[model samples]
Target: MARNAGKRTSTKLVFLLSCAGLLGAALIADFLWASSSSHSHAYASIASNWVLEKSGTVVVPNKEKAEAVKSKNNSVDARILSGTFADLPGPELKWEKMAPAPVPRLDGSAVQIKNLLYVFAGYGTIDYVHSHVDIYNFSDNKWVGKLDMPKEMAHSHLGMVTDGRYVYVVSGQYGPQCRGPTSRTFVLDTETKQWQRMPPLPVPRYAPATQLWKGRLHVMGGSKEDRHEPALDHWSIAVEDGKALEKEWRTEIPIPRGGPHRACIVADDRLMVIGGQEGDFMPKPGSPIFKCSRRHEVVYSDVYMLDDEMKWKTLPPMPKPNSHIEFAWILVNNSILISGGTTEKNPITKKMILVGEVLRFDLNTMKWSVYGRMPYRIKTTLAGFWDGWLYFTSGQRDRGPENPQPRKVVGEMWRTKIHL
Candidate 1:
């Protein structure tokens, strides 16, 4: 009985020891696994060298070499930065070419209504003012000709907006020359395909940024005669029953500073103005033109927002100074996407350089970031957004960086899928 008791005790001791050994091994393995997993997660968040390419692949370059290159160059390429640093968390964007517009044009205004897009007057191929109103049906993907806008009402550098049924155009140059600013305002009934003149703007200006807000048309700063003389007057007109009921322009708070080529839109019930040129750009010195100075055109990077109380507040400026007379922009998901525009103009040649970089501003954060580059450099184009896609129509393209003359206009159209 003693021998049997000793054997039983020994076996019990061995079994307990074996169980303890297995538990110890498991605990060590679990600790190592957890440590490795946490290390990988931490590395991913701080990986500033990685970039999300258009193919949706994350690329990590040599950290030391990339930093060296960035230091040598004054500006860093935002596209090569890591996903976390770039804040590009959305799906990959794909740009696809669409049907070309019927005629090549620039500095045109486009508004989308239902399944159709209406393109208004612009500069034509012969450098002549055009009154063509081209209707593009998104459903059929074709351009259908509409009745031309009245010859007197035809002009470029105008402010245009739509209240669903009626399109309002205000303040533009009556002729192709620089000294033809007009205060005439016209409204086009989309159903009637006819135009009716409304009360003229209180001030004669060209390219004033306009938007329809709370059943009123708000027109902001623009150029008075030449690009240098900017008008700071801001005015609004109330509309009722699809017509301008208030014939007199009601004065609102004037813009703090005036600028030409300003782009305005209403986002989150606030009026926002984007890029423009603040002052006149004179010819460089020693040029053939007498009395010329070396004053270069000043493109603005500043952004301003008007609150409900008609108070203006400056927000973070754009990534760079831009003064492109015409560009495409759309408000989606409380964010504004500004596409291709001109960033600089040669003081001597007066040639403009088109920037292909696409910029996005988050309303919640009030910060701007580069989204990506467009497929091609474009400016003075008509753009509209619908059904998760942005459509860009005819615009002028830059020939080259060395070219001294304005590039030819292109009638090509393109569409890009944007995932908010």
Candidate 2:
């Protein structure tokens, strides 16, 4: 555990606020910025630190001494500090095991609303891909069944977002092969507990990054054909007649960095795209050879921001190179918390391991500062904003024989607080 400047404390563990209520700040009314770098930049109040669970404790590390606490041994899983950024070690932040999912789920999306964690649409091993929806009550600590997807989708990139009413399930994969992608959108109205298909996107894309601003759902770059193909265009969808209607998907704004199948989130009214494979990764829509680039299938850590006016600008890159859909970003107290996601290679086994590292970016500063790593390396872990804490779901370890083989998924959950 590390200490900070403004507040110095000797307490081993503490809970400052509920996870959901911690980052309660006035949303930036507009995207404003001065000429500092290449594009428009805005300044906002930022919380000082981000807290995470390591071994069994909660730890809060600030900008001053961030590099010291990036390991599992020092990680804490302190249960009391579910979402508070306090000074504890990795041991204090690890959470206790809760009820297991009805069945093991992979490639599903989870979102929390009204104290319930809803997980939907994922595939499983042994020849089963499900659209089965499950709900976990954080308060009561119980798992309950919800509605299931009308269709079965596997390897589909699930994008979950909220407009205070329904949870939107955007484009994903389907079919026995689980290879073809679909642009059809689905809405899960928590109020009515009904699922309805929305308008299909102009182009079918899966694994597209999603965000909501001003009640509009923004779908960023995704694989146009499949997970292997990337699309740089962005689309906007709005609710009309109780269904999502595609207003228009404009490729007008050049991305701060282009290449599709990226991950994104909304914070300070700016759509930030994180790590994704870049280059001509997408096949020519109707071609068979699929596609490979003269450029290596390299990973990226660059972060880009898209404004309301569809302007693109680059932000500071992540401290390390990362690819894959294992990363998560959430806004808490004017700060963006990034968790999980692996580096380019594994350190010990020399094979890739699911990463459990955490990083926090202050929206105001536009700089990335290391938060802390998890006790175990987590790859393919689900990161979501619940209550106020950042929830990191199951991921795997890399003890395999290949450069990226022997991957295993963990069935545990961890939470941390943003101390901004």
Candidate 3:
């Protein structure tokens, strides 16, 4: 049990402030906010993995194994999502709908410590964001409990990473959309479930790349306080047991391109960063309403790797431009798999485009491949690998395949076995 468990820093003022300003949402932002969805889907069952035949057509062992499961009841059952080329022997992917999250989340962060998956604070709406943390038991396949963050904790776009026992959450936007970023950082002890304030970031950032590497907590690129400029500064702090050993952060090699909403991972002793965007919907300088510029969104497929010499190097770009994929990655057989996110936008309309392909990046071969596709496109999803199954939950689902637009933020928990 935690030492001081029931105590909470009151966030009522800010929450109300956000709601009070809700009607002041920018035109682009108002257009982006999606209403709830009641869409239902039918899924099939998978027999075996996929194999690419000599004719270059991907085929699965069993194709006609269809299973009828109703998602209306939020049943925790398995469903199959196969390839679109029904005539051809397309790849078959298996997925399960576990219990939905306690609340809809986006722009938040999640970390897995053993079997317990901890979901942090995030936006439930442009005017509303949750300040509590939800815990999901992987073995039990349900939400077991919830914990409230410190009153000072940021509400969304949080940069988070876990060192197995202690999860570090760095700077992020503390209020509603375009309110501003924070320099405050916190760490949660999984054993005690106690969140203790850590050293504040030298500069505040929005959805920065956070990772634990070689006895140090490395914090890198995100956006600045204004939400328009990128924070290219890279800083690290020496620490042990979730406490900073040094007084302040030490300057490190900055990333070539600075941006937020990037996936940061430290695998096999090397640091890697994948798909992210540079600039995004920013509030006009003097407008009381955070008037957004939908046309300014510039999503990218940039991938960067930190070499052993403490120098930054470039890697092969992704198959297409992707962003908003934070926490949507899982490691499988030495390859990094990114599930769903936003891809390129429409050239003429400038509307945000969603992604459905499961991108697999071979760390050994330094190559990228499309493992399969998700039944629907999503962004800001959380991912975890347990019992040999790839589980991801909580994201904004796309409207539909024919008109794949960003829909409402959902609590749907979906899991699939990696066919690769």
CA lDDT, every model vs. true structure: 0.70, 0.54, 0.75
Local accuracy of candidate 1 as per-residue lDDT tens digits, 285-365: 454432212234567788889878878999999887766544478778888888776665532123344666567898889
**Clashes per candidate (backbone, < 3 Å):** 1, 50, 1
- Candidates' RMSD to native: 21.1, 22.7, 20.9
Evaluate model 3: give its lDDT: 0.75
Q: On a 0 to 100 scale, what is the lDDT of residue 75 in model 1? A: 30
Candidate 2 per-residue C-alpha lDDT over 1-420 given as tens digits, one digit per residue, 9 for 90 to 100: 354632444232233444334444322222232244214111110010001111111122232233333343442222222221211133334444556666555556667676777776565641345667777776665676676666533334666676656877777666422356777777778888887776666777666677776556777666666455457666676664346555555344545444443556777666778876553223335445332222224467888877767677778887766555523555677877666554543221122324445767777787876676555554555565655566766544433221123234445665665445
Q: What's model 2's TM-score?
A: 0.66
The all-Cα superposition gives candidate 1 an RMSD in Å to the true structure of: 21.1
Model 3, 271-365: lDDT tens digits are: 99898887765665776856433325578889999968998888999888888887989877899998788876543223455677778899899
> What TM-score quantifies how close candidate 3 is to the native fold?
0.77
For TM-score, the strongest prediction is 3
| Candidate 2 residue spans exceeding 4 A from truth | 1-95, 152-155, 175-178, 240-242, 245-254, 258-262, 279-296, 325-327, 346-353, 385-388, 400-406, 416-420
Estimate the TM-score of every prediction.
0.72, 0.66, 0.77
Error of 1 at 391 (Å): 1.0
lDDT of 1 at 361: 91
**Which candidate do you rate higher for lDDT, 1 or 2?**
1
Pairs that collide, model 1? 50-82
